[model samples]
Target: MSAYDAVLARQSWSKLTQEAPTREELLPLVAAAGRVADHSSLQPWRLIELRGDDRLRLGAAIAEANGDLKPSSKPLRASLLIAVVVSFRPSEKVPRWEQEAVASGVAHVLSLLLDEAGWGVIWRTGGHTRTAAVAAAHGLTENEELLGWLYVGGKPDGKRPGRRKPVDAESLLTRLPSAEGIAG
Candidate 1:
């Protein structure tokens, strides 16, 4: 699909089916996402892709950490889950927000790629974004944020609903000066 068309067609797909992509298929998608322009080559993001039993472990960990926040065992298992982590290391030159933005951009591109591959994908983040328990399980740095998890699988057959929404031109675009334009 065309770049604009892929983005326009993309939607946050929460409900997924039984089929999922292989690791080989996902590697290219991850590479596509990493191509996002990060300030310098910091490459501040890391994705921990979980499938099968690993997803089950994550579901259990999430349930234990959240206590009663999520539903029961079956629904949480999912066909595949990807943890988008912001592995931040404080830098004198770069802002923390920018690092986080790079990571978020990676996740966004991956979502688009998944949609292009005809797989349902969703990004989910919560208070656990900065939680120690969640970070520990994935061996993330102490300062990292559990930005969100992407759930991926196939689209079910039947009536498909379009998610096109009215775009307000003014509300969508913000006229702002570049950092270089601002005084240091």
Candidate 2:
């Protein structure tokens, strides 16, 4: 499919199955995702893929952080869980939020790449997800921040694609300098 076609076809699929790409298969897709529009070439993002029991451990940490005694496998339902982390580099040129924006862009691009590869993906985040406990669970240092988890798996045949509300593009788009100014 063309790049534009892939972008249009990409939809967040939460109702995924246990079928996922192996580490070997995922490496190339990840590398492509990393080729994003990074300002200053700081490369401020990192992904930690969690498979098998690691998901359960993360779920447990999430539960604990939320004051729950039992862990919820809700987040672990997917075959692979990737923790999208923003690693801060002490840069004089780039600000922290800008670095985080780059990291966020990388995650979004990765999700699109996964969609193109016929895998379902969703970026999930909540109060518990960004907590100190969860960060520590994922081995994030003080300089690193846990952005969210990208839940990935094969899309079930009958599963519905994520809801997309109609957006008015004209309302969101704007041309700088009014026609009156130009004519003046």
Candidate 3:
């Protein structure tokens, strides 16, 4: 499919199978997604892939962070979880917020690539994402922040739910007012 069609067709797949893309299959997509617009090529983002026991560790950490008595099965929702981290870089021109946006863009682009590659993907985040326990579980450093995780697996075989509503482009699009109107 064309890039435009792929983008428009992309939707979050919450229910996914246990099958996931192998590391070899993922590296190329990651590289392509990393081509997102960066002000100074700071590359302020990194991804950590989690599977098996790693997911269990993250689930436990999430439970602890939420003060729950039992471990959470959230991380086990998919066979693979890619943790998105914004690694802040000290730059006189690029501010922290811009860097964070770059990181977020990378994640979104990666999701699109994954979707195009026939993988079910969803970006998941919560209030506990930045908690100490969760950060420790991901081994986040002082300069890094947890953006979220992309849960990935094979798309289940069946018809999905209703299609997404079309965006109201006309209502959303606008141009600046004329100079006379602005002055008035």
Candidate 4:
């Protein structure tokens, strides 16, 4: 399929099975996705793969932060959990927000790649993701922030493809109000 067609076909599926991509299979997909529009080449993003016990540990941290004593499986919904993190580097040329956007772009691209490779993937985030306990669990430094987790696994049989509201490209574009000589 064409690149655009692949992206349009990608969907976020929460109903995933334990079958998942190995590290070797996942590494190249992530590397390719890293080729994003990054200003100043700050490369401020990082990804952490959490599997098996690691997910349990993260769930424990999240549960503790939420005042719960027991770890829950809700955060460990998939066979693999990729934590998309953004580390802000002090840059006079680029703002922190822009750097974070680059990281977020990486996450989206990674999700698309996984979906194309027959993996069910979903980007999951909540208030707990940004909490100190959760950050510490992921070994996030003070300058680093956890954007969210990409839950990935095998898609169930006979599941329907994802659907989205068709967007009107024209409605999204706006022409600047005509000043006397502002035409471009």
Q: Pick the candidate with the highest lDDT.
A: 3
TM-score: model 1 vs. ground truth? 0.85
For candidate 3, write residues 12-124 as lDDT tens digits: 89899999999999999999999999999999999999999999999999999999989999999999999999999999999999999999999999999999999999999
Residue pair clashes in candidate 1: none
- What tens-digit string does per-residue lDDT give for candidate 1 at 97-172? 9999999999999999999999988777777556565667778876777888888888777735346587898987
Range of the 10 consecutive residues with the lowest summed lDDT in candidate 4: 175-184
TM per candidate comes to: 0.85, 0.93, 0.94, 0.94
Greater-lDDT candidate between 1 and 3: 3
In model 1, which runs have C-alpha deviations exceeding 4 angstroms? Answer: 68-77, 159-164, 174-184
Give the whole-model CA lDDT for all candidates, comma-separated. Answer: 0.79, 0.89, 0.94, 0.91
All candidates: CA RMSD (Å): 4.1, 2.6, 1.6, 2.4
Q: Give candidate 4's root-mean-square deviation (CA, Å).
A: 2.4
Clashes of each: 0, 0, 0, 0
Best by TM-score: 3
- Between prediction 2 and prediction 4, the one with superior lDDT is 4
Question: lDDT per residue, candidate 4, 1-184, as tens digits?
Answer: 7789997788778688889999999999999999999998899999999998999999899998899989867766887999999989999999999999999999999998998888999999999989989999999999999999999999999886566788798999988777965856
Best of the two (3, 4) by lDDT? 3
* Model 3 residue 27 lDDT score: 99
Number of the candidate with higher TM-score, 1 or 2: 2
Model 2 residue 84 CA deviation (Å) reads 0.4
Model 1 score (lDDT): 0.79
Error of 3 at 104 (Å): 0.8
